[model samples]
Target: MRGGSGHSGRLLGEFRRTPLLVPLSEGDDGGLMTGWQGGVRWIYAFTDEGALARFAQSRGAGAGTGAREWEYLSILGARLVDAVIPTVDGPTGVAVDVADEDASMLFPPVVGIVADAYAVDAGADRADAV
Candidate 1:
């Protein structure tokens, strides 16, 4: 458990420092490409263009065309977790490097990963008060 906790801290710090590639929605008014899983809204971010391309391919973005271009915004992980996540309603989290099984990381909508006000498990600390 200690090692796992250390790993989480290291990973979270690394994620906060790295610049993530966030894909934009295809519309005149571009919005973020997000999804819901287990009631949590996830904002997908890739570590690099290769990672993004792999994800896009897996999702069949272009299908038979074999040539699909995706629009993206490069934002630091800190801003995503600190600024963007708060603006979004409900529990929101960032999913990083989703295409790579070994490299993937999930910044879940928990007390440590998000603002206390937005964290799904914000009250967990209080549970220990008893």
Candidate 2:
């Protein structure tokens, strides 16, 4: 949860993407995705990975990531607007942000992590993200 940090504003602006800890296998290079109730074909990302980790913990049992390695992706918010199809039976919580001209809920693809082998320079530590 990049909880309204001083730097978060810049993050929210340049990087419209949020962080979600998917099990490394959920999304592919093409940005196509699956899962998340009713097969929404949507990519479920969070404001930050902490939010996602908390969510996973709340789910309990198999939902908890445990020691399993997960990968985070920063998807293109514009692509999401194009791919998200609306239907009466689909999941909720997503809408256009009238103020920003973006998905009300947005996330940036993960270019790097705190302890990654590769240097991504997301500009802040994961702890600072919260």
Candidate 3:
């Protein structure tokens, strides 16, 4: 959701309330596995175990020598957007159910989806005016 629309607001609300499974990278820190696209970094969140499984499989996790279960962190969408996204460097956002094309949702780093300080487009108007 790009933000600033009723439908996008509702979708963001629902996403905030949902429980998401976020994959963790293997290491001491076990940080979140992020993706970069459209000049924005994305934190992936799955609706359920099945969704996560699909994503892992697509990444070749269970194929050939790469077969292994993914480690994950269970978190609410709100915490991801409100707390986590802010800590990341540069522009970041949440990607929900990404493996499922029809069910996917993207909460981009815009005014409403992120804090004003972190939003890439937050000061766009002022910049243009300058």
Candidate 3: misplaced stretches above 4 Å?
A: 1-6, 27-29, 63-66, 126-130
Please give the lDDT score for candidate 3. Answer: 0.86
lDDT of 2 by residue, 63-106 (tens): 44465534555555433433332221333222222123232343
1-130 per-residue lDDT for model 1 (tens digits): 1335556677788888999999997778687888799999999999999999888988887556566689999999999999999988888999887888877778899877888899998876576645
- Candidates 1 and 2, the one with greater TM-score: 1
On lDDT, the leading prediction is: 3
Which ten contiguous residues of candidate 3 have the minimum total lDDT? 1-10
Positional deviation of residue 63's Cα in model 3 after best superposition, in angstroms: 6.8
TM-score of each: 0.86, 0.34, 0.86
For model 1, which pairs clash?
none
Give model 3's TM-score versus the native structure: 0.86
In candidate 3, position 15 carries an lDDT of 87
Q: Candidate 2: give its CA RMSD in angstroms.
A: 14.9
Tens digit of per-residue lDDT, candidate 3, span 36-64: 99999999899999999989988877756
Report the lDDT of model 2 for residue 96. 22
Residue pairs clashing in model 2 are 17-107, 17-108, 18-107, 18-108, 73-109, 73-110, 74-108, 74-109, 74-110
lDDT of each prediction vs. the true structure? 0.85, 0.38, 0.86
